[model samples]
Target chain A: MISTHLPALQIILPLLAAPLCVILRNGTLTYWFAVVVAWLAFAVSALLLQEVNAIGVIAYKLGGWAPPWGIEYRIDLLNAYVLLIVSAIGALTVSYAKPSVDQEIGGDRGYLFYTAFLLCLAGLLGVTITGDAFNIFVFLEISSLSSYALIAMGRDRRALIASYRYLVFGTIGATFFLIGVGLLYQMTGTLNIADLGERVAAVGPNRTITVAFGFMAVGLAVKAALFPVHAWLPNAYAYAPSVATIFLAATATKVSIYVLIRTYFTIFHHDFSFGVMALGDIFMVFAVLAMLAGSAIAIFQTDIKRMLAYSSVAQIGYMVLGVSMATVLGLTGGMLHLFNHALIKGALFMAMGCVFYRTGSVSIESMRGLAARMPWTMAAFVAGGMSLIGVPLTVGFVSKWYLLLAAMEQNLWWILVFLIIASLMAIIYVWRVVEAAYFMPSSAGAPTDIQEAPMAMLVPMWVMVLANFYFGIDTKLSVGVATRAAKFLLGDAS
Target chain B: MEWPGLYNYWIAIFLMVTGLYLVMAPQNLVKKIVGLNVFQASVFVLYITMGKVTGGTAPIIAEGIEVYSNPLPHVLILTAIVVGVATTAVGLALVVRINESFGTIEEDEIRELEEAQEDAS
Candidate 1:
């Protein structure tokens, strides 16, 4: 009986714990409370994934009401994989957050921080698990709003402007998404994703659907921080409190990419989305530009956190490029990268968070010759940096390998050239930190008395770094789930 | 294709375009928030207008009522309105904080201040 409602509990557990954090009031208590809640959410997602693997699709009618009329929490291999990623990151980020949050945000506002973190977690999980199109909009706003609050809580005054800019852009993206949902509902009487999928196919190649598609694509593009529309990301990530940056970098935009995949592959038939609309060609162009331009921009950023944020945009391009291929292999690469990049980027950001914790700055100048003092933290950064560069025996290489095979399948040699150049750019950016931290003498302004970040921080950061290699070497779980999910999206279901 | 019948859509499009322009072109942070509100309000109008059934009364179960407009879009829009209000609250709160910190609400002024701070650092 408890097993039947796991889908709903997966979201409700975090949503309810959010207010309880405020009630708890004490910073340490709220920290432990959030940690427990996050882990419980992770356990619930694990069970949900197990159940999904056992049973093909788990569609729990929310409130016992039928799907077309009432909301439904639906989980397939695709979203179950995403749910696990979000919750796992939530758990790790929450555990790592106590030290960082206390140092940066102060204990006075700790409860508020945890509250927003839980809300953002629940929102991302809801966005991934829901089958109702309109439900996605509601949860997307919940996440985005909470995240804006989270970003604004940063000590830097620039965080305020970053959060505000994010607010304006994120609101526009969500409203555009609402308009798209409204148009879909106008055309089709039902708002259930499956029902809309069927009805939209029946409506067949109409102007309204095309317009809705455009609106949704653009809206999600903003959410995912896809190129050109990604102006809000670098500052937001750089200025937001370390905990918020770690969590949002790992999960928020990845969930948006998942939504993009769902819209492109599952809700609308592939033929209509790609063949008639020719969105594949359009996305391909933008994806290539994002890869090149985002990476190129990352090379110029002096702030480590902002550089990773720009790197995220470039990595998003990789996922989009894979999806634009519209083949099972391509989508598998995209999905795998979605999971692997989360691990890789999560570790990198956490390392920077540690740097921020110790030296009170994340600027490259501060990192000069700091590897000797913060050996574990800098080592984790090096491991994560290698993964980011797609070095062999790391998670990044696994996903890039799949992306390469997918590109080759389509005989797209030019895409291969782009991928190699982007990878080289990743090396350049990562090496800048390596050279400063390992080779250059400590700058006079650099703090002489800084020690390693606390064990609480280093442990979680190392867990992520190790997992990057574990998953990379043992590709069975990540690759297996991604392949199944990819096939499911392409309607192969094998 | 009946131009006269689609006046509601025309209004929604106009508001959307105008609201978007306000959001993008405004140098003042508060104006951008206002622009965001107008932009969201346009989407609300689009949703609410689409829900209206011509020659239909309010959605209600009554003995004499024959045709009722769709209630779903209205319900959806009601939720969207709440979201929009929350967004406005957050946006305005952020603007207040921005003003307090930078002592100016103009976007360009804040940028200048930030750049100066960066340069000094």
Candidate 2:
């Protein structure tokens, strides 16, 4: 009976907890409540993944109505994998949020911060679990709205502008998504994704459907911060509260990428999305640009958070590149990168959060001699950096290996060369931080007497850092799940 | 191309373009939020247009009614409108905060102030 209600409970736990956080109005209590709810959601996701592995796909109809007639919470290998990533990150981040948030945001607003945080978690989980097309947009808004508030809560005035810019772009993206959904519903009078898939194929190549696909792809691209439309991300990431930066950087865009995969592979099918629409070529070109441009721009940012934000754009490029490859190996690379990058970036951002808590700044200049003061945090950052640079025996290498194999399979030597060069570019930016944190003497303005971040922060951060190497060596959980999910997405069971 | 038959779509498209232009072309924060509202309203209109059947009545089911406007789009639009309103409220609240901090709500002025602060730091 409990297993049967896992789908509903996965979302409801966090959704209900958000209001409880507000009602409590005590910072410590609200934070503990959120952490408990997040961990509960994580457990539910793990159980759901297990059930999905046992059964094929678990579809829970809301109000006990069948699909195409009611909203459904559909859990397949794809979403189960994504759910684990989001919920795991949510749990870790909320636990880590206490000290980081207290230092950065401070005061009674802590209760409000946790409230928005829970709403964001619920929204993302809702987006992932729903089988209804319209429900995705609703949940997307829930997450996006809460994120705006969280970002605006930063101490700096720039944070307000950053939140505003993100709001404008995010609203436009969501509206475009809504228009796409409306267009699809017009063509096939169903809002359920499975029913739409069947009905859309039967409609067969209408101009409206093609345009609808374009709108949805572009909308998700904006949300995912792909290449040219990625203007909103760097500022939002750099200026948000440290904990918010970590949570949003790790999970929000990853969820958008999942939506992109669901739309192109599940609803539109590979042939329609890739072959008929010729999106593969476009995606490849933009992905390469994102890798080159994102890394290139990252090299110049003085702020460590902004630098990491740019690096995220590049990592997303790697993921999208794998998707654009349209091969089993390629998609495996993409999905693996999704999981791997979340771990790498989560650890990296958590390290940044720790630094900010100690120094009250995230500028590269402030980070000089940090390794001496906070060895554990800097060590974690170094490990995360190596993972970012695709150093061998790290999780980054595993995903990049799959991507390289996919490119080689297609005989795309040019793309192979670009991937290598981009990895090298990653080395340049990450080394900038390493050289500052480890080698340089303390700058005149840098704090001299700072200690390592609190155990609450370091523990969760190290968990992710160790996971980078642990999952790298033991590929069963991450790689095995990713490969299986990739095959399922590509409709290649064998 | 049946121009008259496709009139609703054309109107929706025009509104959408106008809204998108305003949002992009303006420096005033308030205008941008207004533009966003307009953009969302266009979407509502488009959805409503799609749901309309030629001789359809309101979607309440009765024994006499055979032709009914599709109710799904209406439901979807209603939810979307609520989302739009929430977004507007948040956007406006942000603008108010921006004004209080920087003494201006113009995008360019805020950027200049930020640049000056960065230089001073």
Candidate 3:
């Protein structure tokens, strides 16, 4: 007799756990409690995903009211995948946070850090689980607020500025998103996304609807760090605490991409203003620019964290490429890439955290001969980098393969060329670290002796890297579900 | 367009664009955050106005209530408003931290200092 309210509890459990972290006020206790909550959330997400897979779709009306009247929570394959991503990242990072956070943040701020972490984890989970559009906004704010705080907690002074830039851009993004929602409500008089979809389909081709569509599209584009609007990302990731960087990098923009997919392909039918022409053409252009520009820029960065941060932009291009294709396989590639890139980047950033933990810096030049010093950490880095380069037997390769197939399906051979060129650029950037850390002599500040990161960090880091390999070969978890989910979304939108 | 039908939206757009410009173009972090607040407030107004039906009254649970504009948008905006406040509080907290560490809230000055530090390092 487990009810569908379990989805709400999955999110609320973490949200409620944050305050307890504050009251406890001990870093160790708070950290462990957060980890437990995250694990519990992961279990809940698994159960929800299972329930959805068994049933057609699980829709629960809040407060026992019917949809189109009251808020609801929908658990389908699409969001179930997202729920798994955010909650799994939450669980892993909190498990990995003990050593990385201890090294990066001060003791007095530790409890507060875990509190913000829980809120963020809850926000992301809530965003994935909610069926109501307004609920989406509420959860988005919860996540965004915690993200800003988490970024600002960096010991470096640059963290403040990075957080500020993120705040400005993130706020603008959220505002535009709200304006779009407002316009849709004005026209349709419903805040439920499922209801809005029905109403919008009933009354189409209006000026206000078109404008609202634009606003939400652009807002989500910015939030997803698409091309020109991604300026806030590198600095934010670079300056944030390592645990926060890994968590936010792996989940925040991915969830934003989820929102983008949901909006364009779910709430607004494909027949809207751009339909195929504008939506496909615009996203294709931006995805190409982001792919090349992000890789080119990443190649020049001296800082390891900054390089990975830029690489995230390039990876986002892969997801958007699938979106631009506007086919089921294309959307499948996009959604699966969203899940895959999170795995790769989470591992990469955690490796950086290991470096930060030991040497207290992530500058490439200073990382000379790291393979000799911290063999396990460098091995994790290499594995993650290979996945990023789209080597076979890795999640990254599977995603890019599908994306290439999608582009081929659309008969866009040039995008295939562009994607390969971008992967080459990724190689150059990734090679810089390999040469610096594995070949060159250690730099001036390099410790005479290098020590591996603690068990807490190393174990979680390897788990993600291994998951990348596991899912790459299996393909069932990442590919099968994404394909089905894409069909559902594309069919529903049409 | 009627006297106030579509034209009201025109005003909302103006205020929104102006607020967005302030948030994006300003060099001062505090001013930028203030601009963000303004921008979000404009959105709230847009949602409220959108909820207002021509002859409809406030949506209420009354005996034999006949017509109400729409309470859904109003409820949605309430959630958005709380989110807006939370964002403001986080922004102000960051500004306070920045002022403490760098002794300034000006974006350019902060960037220049960071550049210098990067160079020296």
The native-contact fractions of the candidates, in order shown, are 0.90, 0.87, 0.97
Task: For candidate 1, give the lDDT of residue A371.
Answer: 92
lDDT by residue (tens digit), candidate 3, A71-109: 788888999989998899889989999977776787777
DockQ of each: 0.91, 0.92, 0.84
Model 2, residue A185: C-alpha shift (Å): 0.4
2 or 3, greater by DockQ = 2
A232-338 per-residue lDDT for model 2 (tens digits): 99999999999999999999999999999999998898889999998989999999999999999999989999999999999999999999988999999999999
Cα RMSD to the true fold for all candidates: 0.9, 1.0, 1.9
Q: Give per-model TM-scores.
A: 0.99, 0.99, 0.97
Model 2 bad stretches (over 4 Å): B1-3
lDDT of 1 at B40: 90
Pairs of colliding residues, candidate 3:
none
- How well does model 1 score by local distance difference test? 0.93
Between candidates 2 and 3, name the one with more favorable TM-score: 2
| DockQ, Cα level, model 3 | 0.84
Give the alpha carbon lDDT tens digit for every residue of A186-212 in model 1.
999888998888999999868899999
Show what share of the native A-B interface contacts model 1 retains: 0.90
